[model samples]
Target: MWSAHHRRTAILGWLVFVVLATVVGGATGTVTASDDEMGTGDSARATKILDDAGIDEPASELVMVGAKSPDGWRDAAADLSRALDRTGRVTALKEPLPSKDGKEALLRFQIKGKSDDAADQVQPVLDAVDRAKDAGAEHGVTVHQFGDASSEKHLNDLLADDLKKAEFTAVPLALGILLVAFGAVVAALLPVGLALTACVAAFGLLSLASHQLHLFETTFSVMFLMGLAVGVDYCLFYLRRERDERAAGHDAETALRIAAATSGRAVLVSGLTVMVAMAGMFLSGLLLFKGFAIATILVVCVAMLGSVTVLPALLAWLGDRIDAGRIPFLNRRSRKGVHASGSVAGSLLKPVLAKPAFFAVAATALLLALAAPALGMKTEQLGLEKQFGSDAPLSVSFREITAEFPGGPEPALVVAKADDIRSAPARDALRELTRRAGKGAELTVHARQNVAEIAVPLPGSGTGAEAKKALAELRADVRDVRAGTGSAHGPALTAYVGGDLAESEDFTDQLGEGIVPVFLFIAAVTFLLMLVSFRSVVVAVTSIALNLLSVGAAYGVMTAVFQHGWGASLIGSEKVGAIENWMPLFVLVVLFGLSMDYHVFVVSRIREARDRGLGNADAIREGITRTAGAVTGAAVIMVAVFAVFGMLSMQDMQQMGVGLGVAVLLDATVVRMVLLPSLMSLLGERNWHTPRYLRWLPQVSHDEPAPAARPASPTWQHV
Candidate 1:
């Protein structure tokens, strides 16, 4: 439909689609998930029971003040409590609690609305904290604020600031790289412009979808990062091919057709493969994963459509003017295509073609070496201490509170329920649970009617290794309480552990259990896609292995940097000591899809040369050399976009951005440039082999003429 023959129709249709998507998305605002909706496993169940009892735990935060003088500390605590309650955004306020030594005190409160609404209502609470800080200073005390509402506000604000910074950083850097590659301002800007446009459209689509779904806050950034990287990459593939064909002396129409016939087909295949990998996230059985997959799939599909339909129309409209604003020396070099033959890729290909076995073994070994650290990679849900930004006020306050107070703000809430807790046996069970909790841990339990909420004070911000151990011991004793109770009710009542620690542990366990199925699904699907695309079993197997190697290396690098704190010093990150619970599944789905864009494009070019009667060695060199310039340019652009994500203050965003950027670098340089050629060079003619049983697979050509060895008949026509 976007063929040059329908130039005006294609151009107008694309413009309408982008505009319509945005308008519809704006009309229906996004709907965010509730706290219970965000949960999974034991933690989720505990939260649900709390909710059913009409309890609203407003993500309570605290303002802590410390002083040497007992009189000053008491005065500061009174002042802080009154100031917070006067804000009118809080539903309930608790009396200030003082430490035994009278050195510190904390005022706690629940926000007026639900947990999700707390972030939006934090302005009043913040203003109150500001007042407390000033009042504490005058009273000869120190004050700091940290809690659930404060965390939401700070993280949301930080992410918004980081995204704005990324735009200003990534776009200009990408344009400059494109200028160096294309040697013309107009030609270079096209890819970046197209990428930005696609992101806007993807945002529109996601916004519309959000009404029918429960969108997470992180989904927007994920879409932006993925949409921009893949959009530009697809555009670069098509534009480079069109220009190369034009440079080879073809007219405008002919160049576009050949570009569409080749790069366009690769985009379709690559986009489908990305969707397939994204589909694996649905197996996770977590709403967060499913939501992420839906949003990203929308972005990738929209970007793919633009690359095929609108990109061709834009090129057709530009004609000879695409290269109008050419740079002098660079233009001269580009005009003669110096990069296609005299590049480092060309030099590197020689050794691989000469001794395929040696290079193949060496490159494989290096990738595995990079992947070694992942074997010991630890997993955890980031605690408050781990999730906090270094400069966030709440983080500073949290540290102060932990140092000065016996029990900090964060504590584990263990909720247990029964029909009639006032009965003798039920009462004994509750008493026994409370008694057992106090044995080896600092704990307190409160009972009202049929329910009991046991508050376990977690020392050290309530998320350290010792805190977790205490929680485990408390849980072990709960079984004993269950055995002692509920005969009056005629059934044993069980307590569910839920809190920051429980949520993290449950999600990590979920990821661990579900990841194998997701991985196997992606591997099986990608291998089949490659098999169908290449019609060679060896090629399909090689693609799958290389992708695994690249993803494994990414995981290893992430573990070393984020888990082991290897790069924390250089990057100014607070040492997390564990990976984010969601990162491994997220990276796998995204990396597999993205890495395939380059793999399929280069492999298609190689197959074309082979079909054109070149020997395996010659075809490998020509195909890789011909496509190397564009592939490297696209890869660099992608890496640049991802690197900007590393600049964000959020730890999860940093981990993902750096991991993706590094993975792409590895895949393009080692896997694509070195390992691929070596493997193919070793296989020779076997690289193109197709079994008779698989002859029913459709033939998708890549701008290559029909082979003289085969009969002339139309197998497929879309490409």
Candidate 2:
């Protein structure tokens, strides 16, 4: 058990963690020189394409070529160039790069930074392009631009704009919800303060890591916000329990110690669950996922540390000050002078226990109904161009361009190589394949070669079945042609498909395959831990079932809101076919951590009650009642914080935020508050039964000297 001295020691430990984190974080903040040749398949393919096409000049040496035949276009391009010149982020290409075809006019620009950063520099060039649009229209010329800078700029601007709104909405709303739930200024502020500290630490660490590692900027706000939610949520549970114990006549130190031994241990277990679940991302092998895993793990670890150390320390230091502003409007005070038996929480549990079997069955059935839609869930790649508000200028223009000329901006490339570059048979086969591919109304082969690239324009509906089928047919045809040739000299050929759809499909496949193993791993670990801690088979099984229900119900809610487009407009993202591919796995990992927190709290309390000689049924009802209000309060605070993310413009953040928020809310309420207690009540004394072989196992009892049996009275008061 954690004593007052131990609490003080823990506080000192946190101070040490903070000091070390700051120094280590700062030391890693500097960007390091990276080898330009360290690139992936896509990068290599892009390089090969450019080199083969004789456009292999370094991006820094490239410049934008602009024409002034159209009205206002020249002035716009000039103005954008001026802006870029001032920022010095990139060198504006003053001269137009020569076109591969003499018939076409091109505007070429070069960026001095990494390929990723090049997209960040595209905004000014895009603005110039927009300005020149009207001029081009007058002269029957259209401006089309593509480069790393342009894409980066577009994504950066889009994320920045959306994150601005999220900041404005999520923080205030989350705070207000916490304030209402806790009904005390200091108590409400406590979780928020801890969450902010954790998030700030996480952000600094992530940013520093990004200098050396490939960290996605879009996931930063999400990680920060969710970290805040989880931190606050964990603190809320322990603080509420501490307050309850104090009200039950225990001294401050005793109550704090009891809460730590019970809720604190739960916090540790839950945090570990979340950390391990997140660590599963390491299996993905993708740099983005690895970065996300690292960032999430760091945040979870920091939040857990805060929950156990800083939170307890703050409670000890604040003492009575934590209850300074007991808002009469929000406080759920007892109506009569009659003290509710069993820890001031029996009244809430009594109703559910009245019809335990019915409530249990109904809750389970409802969760299953909600989970039904998840079976058919499909994933699609969400791009900034698709997620922007309908009124956004870029979105509108992009839509129009795609509609007018299928795949005008984004085209799928067909890459192939042949041993006999000039062979007539290879030429005939290529032409035949092109002809067959062009027959599909969904796509048009714009360009081709015997040992070269073919630009296949995709349909306007980017992810329609027709597009998928067309790509399939193209692949099949290419395969058939290559198979007929007998010699190794018949052009060693391989096709590399690159596009938003392809990337999305790849991501989705990876996510699906990864989910089962990850969930099983989490469940197995949780089961082993619970079994070890409680030494009860019934307890372990019940915990797993309850956690799954919580996750299921949360998934249902997410399906309705995100997949069904219930509040798409308010969230600033369009319903783009399906959720992001990795969202489910990410949610599972995160929710496992969060849901386990409540499980530990409830189970620990039940064990405490049982140790006092309470019957199994009585112990469950009493434990649930004592913990319900606190768990519910924590869930609400977490939900509110996550809901703030729903207001973000970025589709990825919106999906993750909504999914995590709903999961925590459902897990706390439907699963923990209702289903868990009812099922335990139905099981009666059998709920705590352990196998005969487990009798020799070590027991994890927090209380000393089990209480003696008392008369069976209607009222069972702790004191």
Q: Pick the candidate with the highest lDDT.
A: 1
Across 307-406, the per-residue lDDT of candidate 2 in tens digits comes to 8877877787677888677767654442111133234457656778888888889889988887776766666665546555555655665554445345
lDDT by residue for model 1 over 389-408, one digit each (tens)? 65566677777777766445
lDDT, residue 329, model 2: 67
Candidate 2 has a TM-score of 0.79
Deviation of model 1 at 666, angstroms: 0.7
Candidates in order have lDDT scores of: 0.81, 0.65
Model 1 off-target regions past 4 Å?
A: 69-71, 138-140, 333-342, 406-408, 421-425, 439-451, 479-494, 703-719
lDDT value for model 2: 0.65
lDDT of 1 at 68: 70
